[model samples]
Target: MTAGGDVGGHPVGPDVAEAAVPRPGPVRRFLLRRPGLVDAAVVTVFTGWALLLGLGADSMYWLHEVLGGPRVLLMQVTSAVLTLAGAVALVWRRRRPVLVAAVMTVLGVLSLALTGATNGFELGVALALYVVATTAPPRTLLAAAGASVLALLVGARVLPLARTVGAKSLGVDPDDADAFAAVTGSGPFGFATSPAWFAMAAPVVVLALLAVGLGTLVHARRQRVAALAEAARARAEEHAQRTRLAQASERAQIAREMHDVVAHSISVMVALGGGASAAFDWAPDRARAALDELVDTGRAALGDMRRILGVLHDDDGDGPAGDAPLEPQPGSLDLPRLVGRARTAGLAVRTSGLAVTGLDALDPALQLAVYRIVQESLTNTLRHAPVATDVEVDVRRRADAVEVVVTDRGGTAPATAGPGSRRGLVGMTERAAAFGGTVEAGPYGQGWRVRALLPWNEGDA
Candidate 1:
């Protein structure tokens, strides 16, 4: 299976756990990638050693003397066959560990029965048990162990050497059944002929079962912990992604507000310049003054736009910066220039309750917001109420609040549609709300009217 696929169905069993195993360094990693080659090399060396031992003087003598006269050949042949089968089975051990373990266990029993001897076959049985305990599923390994223990018990009963050893050690009179009872307790313990026999064999069997159970539990626990850790890591990554998306949405909203402010201011300059250019021949002096005011208004708008853009361009633009100082932004202090520009554009603009002192008392952001609101209001009047001969502007500062109102005299001219109509009004309302303020703009007596109320402490500018 591919590495990214579900680990459960991986060709290697779950007990071949990635967590229990340490990551191999360069040389060891290279060797592990081709396990077949490594197995082939190991098997070749083991086969050579087994062959050499089978042909050796001491080994041949022991086998011939221990086994019967004519049966010696059969015993040697049986041992050789079991050895060859086990070596071949190791090649596919990981793919079918349970089946290979069962096969090896049966071969062990067969070798013992045929030769009545423990040799290379014994080593194969031990290696098979290790593989079963390490790689097979829990149920399969338990079944294999049960089968192996049964085989071992039966083999011990039938083998002459096993009987002789058991009888001598247990002190049981072979002819007397009552003596067997005296030595071995009844029930499960009765599997052995006597207590002495149980004492010799039970310890080894118990130790093997304990090792297998402990290893399986350890492997399972580690796997569960690793899975939980992976899940937590995925959750953390998802949260970070959501936070970034929220931040991006807030920035887009700010950009739209700035665009509305700049667009409205630029539209006024364009309209005034167009009107002055068209009347230059009929009213040269008045038109020239209007043209000059248009230049100043255009420059002021550009400077305000650049300042707003600078904030938009900054990395920490969304939050306050306490350590770094900020320059003053345009507000009511620039209202006289705004009024003069509108008057030059052929509207009679009158000012009352105007106070330019203490302008620096307000926050820079609030100041800028106030300037944009007033500028947009005057621009709207010049473009939409051109025939209105007189306009009134009022600014009053109370102990707790500041109020502003702009109105134009009744006229017959229809209101003109411009780029900043609906969008500019929406922007002004949003800006006023930002500093706990409110604005009202619509037709009120004869011409359009605009009014804003800002709190002194809360909406200072």
Candidate 2:
């Protein structure tokens, strides 16, 4: 009955403390933390893929026919240069999207004008369109998409004309005009002369739209992911702010408890020390009693301070000693020891209802509140009522609440509204209010009285 035990005798659990440190998710644990490496790896893999396709196309018979003799060598050299340059531009697309898109666009157009073939440059342009859509502003993304679509349209129209002209310039007859048309379903002016060639432009148009649409969809997905990430970051910061505020509040409460315990104990020891010194000159036996009271009061105060310190130290989940358990907090059952200390301090304190029932049914916090209220009341009586002949301590349990009333006969000392006095009253009021309780302290009849009504919800046990 001297201290509050854990209701369930349970040690501290991990549900709250362990959740503070989270395990990283799969993507986050893998490549997401290394964005630069991921980007470089993506660019390298895509560019190498395009280069392989371009080199395979170079070995085809059609390229030899369209670009024959010295012109054949010229086109191969031009293709190599454009492929390498376009690859470099694509690699830097995320950093400078607009510039990369522009470079890819020009390379696509030059390849159409000279080689008249689909190659690595065209693939680079498509990849750059994707980069633009994801990284650039909305207007810039739309413009880049439009430019890519335009290049596709122009390539379809100009490739046929370029092929005929390139063949004549290379002094090679283009695979016989009728035979080439049959194979490719196009002529020198295929868009104008051939219905099938004009129909083929439809798929090219669809392809362009599909590329732009795919890029836009990817961009939307990226935007959503970024928004979610930002929200998570904001919530984490808010939670951290709240935790800091709670820690500060807990520290302040601990300080007040320490102050009440230490201040009251010190006052009693000092009073007893003075009494012992004065009595020693007249009566040795009286002096010996006061000295013994002084020693006992000092030791009690030291024990209380140590308990308060344990509460403070254990806040960080580290106990006072690895092998030793912390002391239990004082409760309503501890009021006798508290009153005994006051009597030893030389206060004429009398008690009623020492065996109050249903005390164990109250919550530990409420029990502590009741104990502190009585302790602080007795401490104040000892400090301000030295001449008072009688002080009464009462504990009563009603149907819905537990009531504590402390009354002391009037003292010759004048009542002062000093900081320490006001602080003690405030602490008592706060403790009661925590459990939907109320406290009233004022002069009653011929002495000071403190009455506290603390709610007792037995079901809370």
Candidate 3:
């Protein structure tokens, strides 16, 4: 078979895998897909061709006929039958390449012995040798090749043919000559030129070796193609896995952003609206002022949402944005605004070291984490704790870390806001953990306190 055909189960080379190997065309691929059909065709064609060559005049085929002598019908029939058997053996050559090669070589040698020539059937042995070379181990190949070459020399009667041809040309009857069949009155190795039979058989021997070499090349190329295809599949799978991880991480970050922006903005707005409603009847101007604060709070929340959504839109080319320019997230500089919002929401918010010491010098990502932590803490207080609650936000920046502690004194009861999803605390915890930090949230003497400590990264600093 040609190199375009499949060896074992590896499809030789499809177009994509033909980086350096020759790509099999449509006809070859179709034949390769049905190896059984290909084998049957090859066997049939080989049997036909070899049998046709056997139809020549003399029963001796080439040797005696070319030397001008005897013919035998029984010997000719025997050679034909053995040639047919060798052709049929080709059907199983792929399954048992080494065994088939040995069988065909023996049959060819027998044919040469019985008919005085191979009768054009030695090609079967070469075909099997090719298959053997493709699949066998290197040592096995070397052994098989050595055995086949030796068999070829013996079958062609290398010494006998040379001697017989030389004796015939010198007017001696080769059939009556001795084993060496040397020229009349000449020593065994004294022939001046190469004999005719040996000259013809030498090319066939060389062609047999070439068959093995060609098969080796074909096998090597098929292995390379299979390896390339396998590597490509692994790379594609890895890329898909990376894509999945990136998408999951992005979704989680978006969830935290949504909770921080929407939850905090809504909680503060709810507090202002409730205050405005409570004072609407008792104090008209104060209620009007509260309503103004509520409107400002809503607008600011809208702007923050736009910015967040805009970032999403820029990244994925989707989502709503009110043309808010892409800007960095709120960091240490934005904490005062956060505390001011809580105060305006009617919480008695106080501060200690809210100013940045080395916070601005830290990683921006870490700063964002700190900001989210503080924002979530205050949002929980405004929604869960009573209004006019006394809240103390303590921020301390050290050489290696920044700590944020927001604690609120309990009021008479729960605030006007409804129960929360409690996702804010989870967001805070996740944010801190990402930056190698920690958060603690629970009841502190009948009040709620949320503490977060974020470290300064040496690389970021």
Candidate 4:
């Protein structure tokens, strides 16, 4: 009945992935969280076994026979104590690799000198050597490894050779070194010896070098994987930053377009409303005509607003286009209508060099910039220069660029505040500069003039 698929008040699932996953116990969770604890546990267990075997069966009897009845018990007790202490010391090997390795090695050498057996301590020494190789710096690791090799050589080779000489001095047959009675039958030092020195020493050397080599390889592999993971993380962050910047830029562009469209349309409508109110009493016919033009301009502006919003709402266009008609965004071709709307608002608009002779050579974005710059300049002229009777709109094509200039004479009235204050100039500049163009807007010889020069790249059209 629950979301996890509990049936008959008991949890059950047929999904193998869910069923196979069982909750971990507290101890298991603890070990999983701290991997070093698991490694320490394993090392402790192995070392403990080595200690027990080496002391109990491998070397205790030989040591007892060699030391004499009076001192045999003391030597046996001492050997067991030291061997146990050294095995326990391996628990802290990872925390202080070099120091632990040295401590364990010294303990191992003392044990071998006392009992001539190193099975349990040998495992601890090997583990310490591996830890040093993986965690310590190069010089420290080399020093630890060298000490371990020396301990193995001395314990396995030198100690056995010394025992052989002891047996000969006690009048035992050196040739029959493996015989149990050879040394015991002649004197106090006794017991069957282990294999020849070379035979016993080779395996220890191989195992020590092998542990160090494996630890080095594991360290190298971990470092390589960490570097790769860091690189991947950095790249992912960079890509996310780029995506954010692009989204912010897109939102800003949308805001500027909406501002241009609404401000221009409303400015024209406001001017017409004033004109219509003035003519209503003296010329009713002219007032009706102005009202009609206002209505048309408002409708066109509404349509353009819908088109812009449609690109956001149904970007993929799977819905009906009649609701929010999807149309090509207006570019240079829409400038004529813009000029006409300005003229209808009663300003005496004159033009020269309005021909688009080289428009086919410009990119779509550059053409859009040209259209928007002209549109904003005209809107500014209408709002700020209401007393001016003459306005000039000009477009000229040069060798590498197309220039647009809008000039308006000063009016009798001073400038008044307008919607989207100063943003019109900023938007114009942004649009022009996006295509590697330049914009200049300021006073020009008793009139305000706005000029923009956009590069014409014929190959990119």
Regions more than 4 Å wrong, model 2: 1-81, 137-142, 158-160, 163-246, 312-327, 353-355, 414-421, 442-447
Query: Model 4 off-target regions past 4 Å?
Result: 1-37, 56-59, 68-80, 151-204, 310-323, 358-361, 418-421
TM-score of each: 0.57, 0.73, 0.72, 0.77
Q: Candidate 3, clashing residue pairs?
A: none
Superposed on all Cα atoms, the candidates' RMSDs to the truth, in angstroms, are 9.9, 6.5, 8.1, 9.8
RMSD of 4: 9.8
Clashing pairs in 2: none
Off by over 4 Å in 1: 1-66, 69-188, 192-243, 246-254, 301-359, 375-411, 418-461
lDDT of 2 by residue, 1-461 (tens): 01221113421222322333444579867876787787777567656765565445533346566446677667767767777777677668879877887887787677667666545555566677777776777798788768776775566555764445334333345657764454334545545654333433454456456656787887787777667555556555554555567678788788778878976777677667767888898988988998998888887777777666665554555555332345677887788988887776667888986578767567888878888898888878767776567899999888888899999987766643233448889899988888898999998777889999998765855
Q: Of the pair 1 and 2, which is ahead by TM-score?
A: 2
Q: In model 3, how large is the Cα lDDT of residue 150?
A: 74
Compared with the true structure, what per-residue lDDT tens digits does model 1 show for residues 3-58?
A: 32222353332333334344457987788798878878746754554444333424
- All models: lDDT? 0.62, 0.69, 0.72, 0.71
Mark the 10 consecutive residues where model 2 has the least summed lDDT. 1-10
Candidate 4 accuracy as lDDT: 0.71
Q: Residue 195 deviation, candidate 1, in Å?
A: 8.0
Q: What is candidate 3's lDDT per residue for 32-100, written digit by digit as tens?
A: 899989898878876776676555623334454564543545655776788778877888899999999
Clashes of 2: 0
